[model samples]
Target: MTTGKEYVTAVFEKVKAQNSHEAEFLQAVEEVFDSLIPVFDKYPEYIEENILERLVEPERVLSFRVPWVDDRGQVQVNRGYRVQFSSAIGPYKGGLRFHPSVNQSIIKFLGFEQIFKNSLTGLPIGGGKGGSNFDPKGKSDNEVMRFTQSFMTELQKYIGPDIDVPAGDIGVGGREIGYLFGQYKRLNGYKNGVLTGKGLTYGGSLARTEATGYGAVYFAEQMLKARGEGFAGKTAVVSGSGNVAIYATEKLHALGAKVIAVSDSSGYVYDKEGINLETLKQLKEVERARIVKYTEHHPNAVFTPAGGDSIWTIKADLAFPCATQNELNAADAKALVANGVIAVTEGANMPSTLEAIEIFLEAGVSFGPAKAANAGGVAVSALEMAQNSQRTPWTFEEVDSKLYQIMKAIYTNSAAAAKEFGEEGNLVLGANIAGFLKVAQAMSAQGVV
Candidate 1:
């Protein structure tokens, strides 16, 4: 009898051999594959159909060049990528990231993760991600506009609301999405649903900005309730001062938790008296300044440079790693556990390392994986699409209520799947198996497209 670990190792070895240079993609694959071993034991038909091999490969990969002129009249060039990883369930749906670090590996990894994340949403959407290597920081509004127009000039041919819908992620936000949508409309003409995360004046859905962050807190609340605990009086340390972290902190406060810390790429801010939400929003969303500037406004707060994994050392009852990929590792996990942290929820995609996840599971800490916890953003994106299709809009309260129900459903489904698979309460396994089974069954029914 082949042990689960041995089977997982075999599948992972094949993935590594094929994608030696795609480290990020391989990591995502390994994580999902590792969790599917128990399911494979129960359903040999999945192996017989070679679903692992099929799911690992993408349905399509598109790459193009983007050329635009800066304020200095100098022509600049960047690479753009769109990986439509899976459409087994519905049209391709994901966000478009714009950062200097954007690469094929990162895009593929994000797209691959989207498959399961979309599945967990219980919505009729598939997995896809698109982005470019163009860094939008420090660029004037016109410069950014010209670049987005150029990027959309090439991208407009491949995307539509029913085909692939792109939203905001990381460096891409309302400003960037606005530029992209404007250009797309100019070229394609009046397609409101083709892009998500739009301004409220347009087809953008309410509660979209707060979806991922709010959904994470809602999931955390459910996790706590499972253990006879709640967010009241708990201290939280949330890394990253971006939309996810900021709104997550806001929701935490509303739920009776004090978020003491939040970070950015440059460093993190620790406020012993609790983080001021308005101050954080001004720095991050309005001024667009570095997180270190937070201390200048709140004299009582202390700003510390971000050494590798230093944010994990902060003691708190709950930790939300809303930073980038692999930000939390085994060492960080150890520190969190040592600090008596009870729950760790991810607001960013794949923010926790596999080793760190192992540490949390071993210590019996409630860990909310990124796919399930962060699906709120994409879930609401789907809602925006529905509104566009119907030519109607939903109120903030209505959208938020629906988001809450979706998050609750995700937690319940994941928990039920985990219990069914003998890893009771292991969200990692629960999410992977539940999401995998959905996509796998869809793929099998579709006849291996």
Candidate 2:
């Protein structure tokens, strides 16, 4: 009889052999597999059913070429991908990323992580992800519109409201979603719920833009409360100057916590007296400028042209990694722990490396995994689908209240699962086990496909 650890190792080896060159995808698989030993011991039936094998492989992988014309009338080509990872629980639901770094491996890793994250939301939505290596930065509106329309022309064939609904991610925000949704509507004759994160005038949900950031802060608050601590006077450091980081700063301030720093890809801005939200909003949202410009608005703030992960070294009570995957590493984790950081909540997908997570756990830091912590965006996206189905738009307060409740529920369930599995305060194990159990039962009931 194979032991649980051995079984996990064998399954992981198969994954590695098949996806030898996909470093990001393999890393995600290994992280999730490391926490499943206890689960396998409790239920050997999952192994017999080959659930791990099926779960790792996407149900359908679509790849196509997106050809568009630039503003200068030059022809440009980009590769696009959509990985429908799972549909056992419900229809596939995830975001579409648009950046230069997007590839099959990144998409697959994100799609795989989506499976567990969506499951943790307790919403009737499966896991999937799609993206294109088309950078929207420095592109004119006409160029972006042309590219989005071309991308949607092919993507429309595989997505629908009841089949698979795509939302926005890193580079795909409201403007891009509007263009994509318009193209989908023109092609398929107005299926409003097919794509989420649409503009307010269209069938978009309120609070969708701030859901992920607010949700991360809410989860962090829960973690602090579990330890008899609160965010009354604590200082925070947030990475990234995008939607997640911006709104996280807003919510942190509202909760009485001072956010001293925020970063972009080029560098970070450190303000000892707390970041000015209005300046950040104008710089990142309106102007779409780099984070270093923040120092220009506030002369007292210091702009450090350092690496994206450098924010982790700042002495603070809370840390939120809202940047890209693997941005936070073991060394950064050590710095945060040494600085007496109380809790770390992820606002991005797989932002922290496995080793960084281990170091934090070893130091007794209250860590919230991305799957459980950053589920707010998708949760609100699901709510948007509901509103669309009912032909009703909810107010900001209504949507925010529901989002808070969902995030609170996620924390409660993760903590309860940790306690149940004899790993109290270990949210990584708790999130993985709790999320896996849901998908496993659904797969079992549906039987082999």
Candidate 3:
């Protein structure tokens, strides 16, 4: 039998030999594998067929041109991608991001990460991710609508309820999902569950909007509970003003944490009054304004346009990075440590760079990796799939409570895996091993594809 180190080394060799992968994507995959060595030791068939080699790469990657017309009669074309990474346990499940950075490399990394994250959720959802390099930031509603419709027209061919179901991520939100779903329904007719994060008027479940953030907090709560602590008196600083950040702030407040700061791409607003959650929801969810504008409404809050770095400097017991990848780096991690931050939880995919994560781990903070912490969104998406399968909608409270339980269980399992591997408190190791074992077992039972 191949040793675990030999298996992991062979997997990395295969990864390095691949001609189609980008450096960032390869590095991300390598990081996950680096933490999954213990799991391979525990389950050796993963070494025989080299399951790691097969699973490290995506099963299929769909790239298409999304051409749309702007209101100015100008033609705009964007690159769209859907990477169905794995489907060992069930159908493909992930999110669709819409941003300038949505390239094959980034989407592949996210899809690869999703494979494990979905597995960790203990839900029968596989891993896939789709998105476009179309920036919806400065676009008009009509332009966005046209773009969404055009994108979905082609994407619908490759996705479905039982094939691949996608939800919102990053630049994509309710409006974008509405537009995509409208186009999808128009083409494929009214079959629910093809996409999650749908509008409630259609078939979206309750607590879906708040799942990622609330789930992160819920996972954090579990982590704290394991250590005889909780969020009751913690001060938190969260980054981003989008769906995840807003709801993360809301949940932190609900748990009695004073969420003192939240940011967007432009700037961050720090309020000593513990971040007015209602005011923030009105600004981002309703008004769709810049986060700096927050200080205009509340003169007491300090608005810093210095980006995520400013938020990292705030004194807090918890720091939740809910923005895009690499938003927090080594410098920011140092600043957070200087501020006496006790925990760093990722609400976005790889929000912290390698150096930042190393810093957090070395500091002995209760760090919750994105896969385990952010699995709430996909877990709830799986619940949405259940509702769709049964043709029945669960009440908001029911779904919310279910989400809470799943998050707790994920934390427990991930934490247990970490301890069993002799890497207690290292959730990065725990989550990767726990998630990998699930997918690997399913793949083993299904035989070689």
Candidate 4:
């Protein structure tokens, strides 16, 4: 007999009571639940069936110990985790992150986000994520290989092409994917569909590397066009020097936006004359050097040691938060809005805190939530799975074109859902509602387990 808001509050309270220590997971769940108030009101059957209760809980959670040998002939141990949040729509698909910060909370948060992000792509993908507390930083190639090999030795047992597919996330890249795929192949034979983000020599999809960054830019362009604005002749700032930030900058520059800054964990490189993509690729991608090294190559560019959300202080027409979760906060959002940022595109999962999102919306910024704006990576990941299943590979341009179309469709769907739900232009709510309705319907059709 509870009202819609009351039901949402009750479900969220139950989640929090059960997972009091999981801050990241709680935040993600709360955000989605907040957006479902309208949906719950419209479809009271969802409440009667306890869909929120079941949806909030992960279907499967696997935890294991990953022990590997370092180059020094010493044994190291790390915790590995995988959570299959849902499989209502299709196979559980997500990424494996390798970082010291990888924990149950982070993985659960990511897996939970992946459910909506994947559903928003209009792809038959569910939600799953796996990772380890294994930090790849400063590790030798052999060390990384040994760790990934050991990690996959166990992980391969649970995943298959038609079941759960894990790609790469933070601290996981082509090198790690190559190592993990090799181990999976060594154990289970040549299954290209077991993972995405593989090297070109293998079954990796073309443009998979650039899909996330490029997709964010593509989604941002749609947002701007809707507002009768565009990216031409505008200043922008992108955080992180990783794959997402780099390619997002590339796409932004291609759309006639001058991206003046890009950062790494150590610091941010600000180039008033515009960031040199070639130099950046060489330093971060090729050499794997620090952002400070950019200053060494281009003396004109300034390298500030202030990393994280500090990049928001730089005035620009657009803001691309391609960094880590909660990197941008209320103060950072205030700074970006005060500086007249036109759009804020998320290229990273949950990069902006809840308060930061509110600030952007209140200031009339064209905000692209991560679930809608960043679905490109997984959309192409599904495409890669399709190619792998058919034993055919797509050309770079072909994949890029498809990625653009998918991003456009995601934008349209999210905007329409928001408008229909009486929160026009509120993409956060729109994305959550649109994605949830799809999975909820699927789950309902399948009946309760």
The residue-by-residue lDDT of candidate 2 on 1-449, one tens digit each, is 66778888998999999999999999999989988888888888988897888899999999999999998899999999999999989899999999999999999999999999999999999999999999999999999999999999999999999999999998999999999999999989988999999988989999999999999999999999999999999999999989999999999999999999999888888999999999999999999999888988899998888744488889999999999999999999999999999899999999999999999999999999999999999999999999999999999999999999999999999999889888999999999988999999999999998
Q: Put down candidate 1 lDDT per residue, 258-349, tens digits, no spaces.
A: 99999998888899999999999998899999998888889899888866448889999999999899999999999999999999999999
For candidate 4, lDDT tens digit of each residue in 1-449?
66789899999999999999999999999888999998989999999988999999999999999999999999999999999999999999999999998999999999999999999999899999999999999999999999999999889889999889999999999999999999999999998998999888899899999999999999999999999988889999999989999999999999899999999889898899999999999998999998999988899998889644488999999999998999999999999998999899999999999999999989899999999998889999999999999999999999999999999999999999999999999999999999999999998899997
* Candidate topping lDDT: 2
Indicate the residue-level lDDT of 107 in model 2: 98
RMSD of each: 1.4, 1.0, 1.4, 1.0
Record all residue pairs in model 4 with backbone atoms less than 3 Å apart, i.e. clashing: none
Alpha-carbon deviation at 282 in model 4, angstroms: 0.3
lDDT-wise, the better of 1 and 2 is: 2
How would you encode candidate 3's per-residue C-alpha lDDT over 1-449 as one tens digit per residue? 77888889877887788734575577578779889887778777678867888897789999999999999999989999999999998899999999987788898889998998999999999999989999998899999999999999999999989999999998889899999999999998998889999888888989999999999999888878877888998899999988788888888888888999998888889999889888899999898898888888899999888633468988899999999888889999999988888888899998888889899999988899999999999999999889888989999899989999998888889889899999998999999989988898888898889
Per-model TM-score on C-alpha atoms: 0.98, 0.99, 0.97, 0.99
Better of 2 and 3 by lDDT: 2
**Best of the two (3, 4) by lDDT:** 4
Count clashing residue pairs in model 1: 0
For candidate 1, the TM-score is 0.98
Backbone clash count for every predicted candidate, in the order shown? 0, 0, 0, 0
Q: After superposition, how far is residue 328 of candidate 3 from its true place, in Å?
A: 1.3
